[model samples]
Target: MQYIYAMMFALEEINNSSTLLPGVKLGHHIHDSCSLPAWALQAALSLVGGDMPSCNSAAKYEEEKGIGASKGDQPVPLIIGGCNSVTAQIVSRLLVPLSLPLVSYTASTPSLSDKQQFPNFFRTMASDVYQARAIAQLAIKFKWTWVGAVVANNDYGLMALKVFQEGIQRAGVCLAFVETLQRENIVSDARRAALAIQASTAKVILIVAWYTDVMELFLQLDKLNVTDRQFLASEAWSTSSDLRQSTFSHKVASGVLGVAIRSSTLPGFDTYIHNLNPLLRPNDHFLKEFWEKEFGCSPGIATASPFASLPPCNGTESLWAVNNLFTDTSQLRVTYNVYLAVYAAAHALHSLLFCPDVNSSPGHNITCSFTNQIKPIELMEQLSKVNVTTPQGEAFNFQGADITGKYDLVNWQSSPEGQVQLVLIGLVNGFDLHLNESAIQWSTGSSQVPVSICSEACPSGTRMATRKGEPICCFDCIPCADGEISNTTGSTQCVHCPSEFWSNAERTACIPRQLDFLSFNETLGITLTAVAVSGVTVTIAVFVVFLYYRQTPMVRANNSELSFLLLLSIKLCFLCSLVFIGRPSAWSCRFQQAAFGISFVLCVSCLQVKTIVVLAAFRSARPGAEALMRWFGPGQQRGSVCFFTSIQVSHYFDNLSFTPDSVHIQWLSEVYTYYISY
Candidate 1:
C-alpha cells in the first residue's frame, strides 16, 4: 500500500511541475499483486489488454479521453510491479511479446540481468549479483572461514546462493551445511534448517531468503533456543518490517549483520503518508482495507467486507496517531525505489511526447505533435535511455537493465528499550567494503569479534599440514625439520638452508655453522699438549744422562751409542705428538703424521739393534762365538738401525703424494686410530 502511495506521490509531483511535460498529466492504475506471481501476471495481462476494471482514477481519465475506444489500443504504456523476483520473472515474460516496459522496484534476482531474456525489464533496485558478492566479502573481512548457509527455494534465494558459493570457494571459506527452504514446505524446511544450524560448529550462518521465509526460520530457531550463532543476511529480508516486528525478533535476529539496499528519506513523503484518510478516497477499496487493518475499524458498513466484524470507522481516524509500516517513512528504501521508477517512466513519456526541435523558429509556438495514444515500444526505447537525478543529489541511471548496486552494511543491535535496531556500520559498493568494526554490537555482548575457523593459524617455526578427509582450513602445525627453516607463520612447506648454513635450534632461521676443530685453548687440547711436553722433557733428560755417563763401565756394557740414539728417537716421537693439539693446517697435518711414524720406527729399530748386540756379547762368552761379536759390531748395528729408519721415511713421503692439501677436521679421529695401530 505504501508503494502504491509512493507511485501516486511521484505522479502528482510530476503533474504539478511546470518545467517537465508542461501540458501533459500522468495517471496511474494500481493493482494489488498479493505477493503472488499468478496474481501479478493476471494484473499485467489486464493492464496490457485494456480490459482492466474501471475502479481507479487512471480508468476514469481513459474513459474521459475515450482512449480505450479501440480494442487494439494499449491503455497502459508501462508497468511498475512484481516486488519479488518470481513475480517479476513471470510478468516480464508475459510483457515481452507486447514490448511493454516493466519496471520493478525491488525484484533483485541476478538472472534478470540478462538483456536477451528480460529486454524490456528494468528495475530501480540493483540485481542480486552485487548483493551476493557483498555478503561473501563481509564473511571474508571478518575472517569467518567456516559458516553455514540457508537459502530459499525461489529464484531470488537460489540465484544469490549460487553466486555467494562461488565467491566463498575462491576465498577458501568452507560451508558447514547448506539447507534449502520452500514456501510450500517453509515450516518443515525452516525446522530442518534450524536443526542443521544448531548441530553445526560454525558460529556464523548466512541466510539468503525472503522476509516470510526468514520469519519462519527465525521462529523455528527461537524455539530451538539457538541464539549464540550470528547471522549474515541478504538484502531480501535485511530491513524487513515484518521480520523486525516478529515476536522472536530480539532473540533470533539481534546481532545479525546484513546487507540492505541503499535507502534515503523521501522529502514530504512522511507528511503525505500522515495525511492519508479513507474518507478522502472512499472509492479506493485498498485504502479502505489498509485503514480498517491499521485502526481496527471498517470504512463502510458493508457486510461483504473482510473487516465487517470490526467497529465502524468514524472517517476521522488519524494515520499520524498510528505508527505502523504504512505510516513509517523514516527508512524509505523500497518506497523510494517506487518513486524512482515512476519518475523514470514519466521522464521517458515526456521525451516521447515532447520534442525540442519540432518547431525550430523562434516566432513559431512550441508544441508537441504526439497523439494521445502512446506506444509501449516507443516508451520502452525512451526508458532505456532515461537518466535523471533525485532531489537528494543521488544520480539515477540504468546499467543495462538495472541500476548500479550499492548497499548499507547494517547490524541488528539491541536498543536500550530491548528492541532490535538496524544500525549502519558500513557501506558496500561493488567489491569494496568500508566497515566501522568498532561500532559493531556482537551477539556475545562483548567487544571481541566472533571466531569461526576449522583450526588455529600455525605459528612461526612451523608449517601447515592439511588433515586428511577435511578442508584446507583444518590443518595441523608441523615443526620444520633440521637444516630447514620456516620463518613465516603458516608456511606450507619448509625451505632447506644453504650449504654453509644450518637451521637454529627452533628451526625458524638459518645461521652460519661453527667450525669443528680441537684448539690448544680447550681443556682436552691443553691436557694432551702438557702430556706430550712432559714425555719430550723426560726423554731429553734421559738422553743427556746417557750421553754424560758414556765413559762409565755400565753404560759401555749396555751399548751406549744405541742407548743415546734410542733416547733421541723417543724424544722426537714425544715432540711430534704436540703437532696434533692445535688448529690443523695443510703443512701441520702432513708433518704431524710423517714425523710420528718415522720417529716411532727409528725407536723400535734402535731397540732391535741393542737386543742383537746383547745376544752377540753373550754368544762371545761361549765356544766359537768370537765371529758373532765381530759380525754385530757398532757400525753394523748402527747401519741396521739407519736402514730401518730410512725405509719408514721413504714410506711417509710416498703416502704424502696421495694425501689432500687440507684434511677435514671431522676425519682427525680416523687418522689417529690408523697411526696408533701402526
Candidate 2:
C-alpha cells in the first residue's frame, strides 16, 4: 500500500540566522508537545529584563531546565503543530496577545485562521470546511441522497462533521442521521454499538472518527456482520493497509465513497519526489549512475526539498528548530512537514525582522535580537503571495480562508506477478497548477505513467532513503547492522556483514561466513578467521586473473561494458566470501542474508549487461557486408563503464577526487556568495 507515513522534522535555522540588528547569538528553548501546558506557554511569551533565558544558562541547565528568567525578559516565539484542534485552539489563545506566531500545518478548523480572534495563527492545509465541500461534492457524485454521519466526539470531529453537513446540504444531499461516536465506547460491546449506529436511516455511513477509531469500527462491524449500509470515509482510509483487509470490509464498503486529494495530482509532487533530497543537485552525473543502480530509477532522491526552507542539518535537513538536535521528519509529507512548518516560522521571523518597514524600539538588549512584531494578518498581508518552493512541498500560501489546491489519487495495484504497484487513478486540479514534469500524463483520472516508488525496499540497516515517505515512493538506506556506515541513502550493503555470513561485494547481503578450506577446524571462530584470510587471498586471486587470463573470455570480456561488470561481480563475490574471515554475526539474520542477495544480484547483473554488450558489439561488427547488418544489426555502437577493478583502479587512484571538506566548503561558499555551486 502507498504508506502515508507521518513524523516531524526539526530545524535549527535560527541558531545561525540574524536580524536587522546584529550581535545577538540567537538562543532557543523547546518543550515536548507532550506536556506543554497553557500557563507554561504563556510564560514563554512574556518578556522582561533578566527574566528570560540566556545562552550562558545553557551550560548551567545542561542537565536541568532553566526556568523563564524570573522576570521573563525575552519573548519566546513558538512553532507548534495542529495534530489536533484542541492544542491548536489553546495555542491560538495563548499566542494572540503575545504577538507570537502559531503556524499550523493542518489546523483547518477555520476559527484559528479567522484573523480577528486569533490574529497570530497561520495555516498551510485546507480547512475542514474546504475538505467538507470536497466530500460533499463526492457524496453528490455518488447520488447519495441520504448520508449518515458517524462522528467522533473530538473538536476535529465536531467541526469537520458540521462543515461536512453544511457542504452536503449545499450540494443537495438529504440530512441522514448524525451519530456521534465516543472514544470510550470503542471497546464496548459491538452489538450495542452496531445497534446504535443502525438507527441512522441513511444507507451510506460516513464516520468522522479519529483515524484509529474509524478502522476499529470497521472491524467491529465485520465481527457483527453490520454490512447493511455502504461505508464512506475520508483521507483516513486513503492509505490504511488494514482497512481493506477486514472480512466484511469490502462487503460493507464495496462501493464505499470517500474524499481525498490524491497526493501525486498535486503540482510539484512528481518533481519533488524526483528531487526529494534538496541537498543533491537535480541533475548530478555520478549520483545518477549510483542511484539508477541502487533503486532502478533516479528521480526523487535528494536530501531535502526546495519547498522545505529550513537550515541544512549536517548534510541533511532537520525539519524543525527544536532547542537542540532535530530529527528528520515527514508529517503530511511523512511527518517531517512539521519541521518545514517550524522552519517557516524561523524564516518569517527572519523576514519580518529584516523588512525595511520593520521598526525596533531603541534600548532593546544587544542579546535580544528582536523578531519583527507583525500581527498574523499584517504578516500575511505583507508576505509575497507568490508560491515559495519548499523542500517539503506541503507548506503553501494561505488560500484566503479557502484551501484550493490540486490533489492526486492513486491506489496500490497488485499485478499477476504479485508485485505491488502504485497506479495513479485520478488527478483533480482544483487550483489549476501547470506542472513541469511528464509523469502525470493524464489529468482528469486516466491511467498514465504516474510518479511511483517501485518498492525497491532499502534493507533494514538502511533507514528510508527519503524521509520515511517523501514523494519518491522508494525505501531509504541506513547503515547496516553490526557496525560500518555509509553517508547516503539506499546503500548497497551493510558494514561488516559479520563472521557467519560472508559480506557480498555491494555489502547488500552476506553469504554463509564459511571458509572453503576443504579440510580445517570446524569451530566458528577458526572458520571466520579462515574467511577473512580467504577474502584477502581472493583479492590477490582476482589481481592474478587480470595478470594471466587478462585476455580470456572472463578477462577479455572485461573490455566490453557488460563483461567488465560481470567480471567485477565475480571478483566482488570472491572478495566478500573473505568477509567470513573478518567477522560474523548469528546465523539466518537478514543483515548477512541481504548482503549476499545484493552481491549475487550485482554479479549476475554484470553478466546480463555483458551479454547485451556482446550481442550489440558483434551485431555492429557485421557492418554493411551485403547489407545484412543494415537489415538485421549494424550501427556505430557506443558502450560505457564496466567498473572492472583492474582497469578502474587507474581512474580511481589517479583521477577520482577525495578532497571532501574542501569540495563541500567551496560548494557552500559558492552558493552563498555567488548564488551557484561549481
Number of the predicted model whose TM-score against the real structure is largest: 1
Candidate 2: tens digits of C-alpha lDDT, residues 126-166: 56665555666656654565666777676777888887777
Candidate 1 segments whose C-alpha is farther than 4 A from its true place: 53-74, 296-304, 308-315, 357-369, 518-678
lDDT of 1 by residue, 540-560 (tens): 888788788889999998988
What TM-score, to 2 decimals, does candidate 1 have? Answer: 0.74
Instruction: List per-candidate RMSD values in Å.
Output: 9.9, 34.4
Per-model CA lDDT versus the true structure: 0.79, 0.46
Report the lDDT of model 1 for residue 631. 80
